[model samples]
Target: MLELNDISYMAGNRTILQGISFNVRKGELLMVSGPSGSGKSTLLRIIGDQLSPASGSIRLNGRSILEYRPEEYRQKVSYVFQTPTLFMDTVIEDLEFPYRIRSAAPDMERIRELLPEVGLTEEILQKESRVISGGEKQRVALLRSLLIAPDILLLDEVTASLDRENARMIENTVKCLSARGMTIIWVTHDPDQLELSDRVLRIRDGKVVESIA
Candidate 1:
């Protein structure tokens, strides 16, 4: 379980999160929802350790997150932002990055199998990253983020721009991952997406207003 104790954050003297606390159980799919600027994204960023909260503590299975080294923590916590960036030239180059970081050979069979699941085909791997459509780029980015199957996957509005078909592909893929024991904390405003969650946490003005379990 991940335990958050009285979390708070500040941005240029403005409060982004205030005295927030929550717990995420193992393999649970927790959906976070709120209006714009309510600090939903910031909360996920804090949990991902992409940003440090001004106060409070975050623990993963009884251990403080701070105890883990930066590189080691990142491998266990994956964060997928709303706007994806493909840093490499070809789709395959970007997809192969995780393997490179781990000093392992590219898992071609696994990559090939996952491509179709995200509404892409084998040929997309050869396509130039800069030329793909927005939906396609998001698909490839999402696929790459999941390649290693981190312990906790933080998704922030990943499918908000996708068409129904593509969005369902991502939704189903994460649902499958969650069932297989990869804990997912998904941030979405879509009602359909909310229905897919194991719990819903709603916040406003930097504070949690409601939580449905």
Candidate 2:
């Protein structure tokens, strides 16, 4: 569903990604594993169009990503950062914001259902977002992203900081999404996460190597 051809990026004189290329099939769960500063996140940012590649191109559905409007592209390809940002006063407000932007009413029932799936409760949604723990905040951010039902989900170490239980919750939730045909590109260092992937690519020094399926 998505293809990256000879992708490269640079930060001033430093290279971030060099000659990176990969294809993520529809409904496939692809795991990107590498040490810090290996360009996994950069690869994701490029795919999400947050960073322009210095060379090469990204295609979604056989069309260049540049062909789609920025807002429209982002809606279809969602990126969840490792450290989730919640600027809203309450969790519910954060969750409702996406629907509000589309000028549609919030789906309360779906929100309620999703909350527990991510190890959160309905009551927590009423609490102040700033007061929540990091894990809770991450879960809320994840739920907010899923509320939009993006076609491709780019997860950047989303469960890196969560406890085992919470991480499992997220893994299972993502597996369910994959089962439903959502393309997932997950960046994680955890070996368990690697074990669950349909394909794994190891990146180092901005290069892709040691791919397994």
Best prediction by lDDT? 2
Q: List the residue pairs that clash in candidate 1.
A: none
Candidate lDDT scores, in order, read 0.90, 0.90
- Tell me each candidate's TM-score: 0.94, 0.95
Instruction: Estimate, for each residue in 1-213, the C-alpha lDDT of model 1 and write its tens digit.
Output: 899999999999999999999999999999999999999999999999989999999998789999999877888888888888998999999999999988999999999988876778998899999999878888888788778867888999998887888788888878888888889999998987898889999989999999999
Q: What overall lDDT, based on C-alpha atoms, would model 2 receive against the true structure? A: 0.90
Off by over 4 Å in 1: none
Q: What is the lDDT of residue 147 in candidate 1?
A: 86
For candidate 1, the C-alpha RMSD (Å) to the true structure equals: 1.4
Candidate 2, 1-213: lDDT as tens digits: 898999999999999999998898999999999999999999999998999999999999999999999988989899999999997999999999999988999999999988877778888989999999888888888889888879899999998888888788888888888888889999998988987789999999999987899
TM-score of 1: 0.94
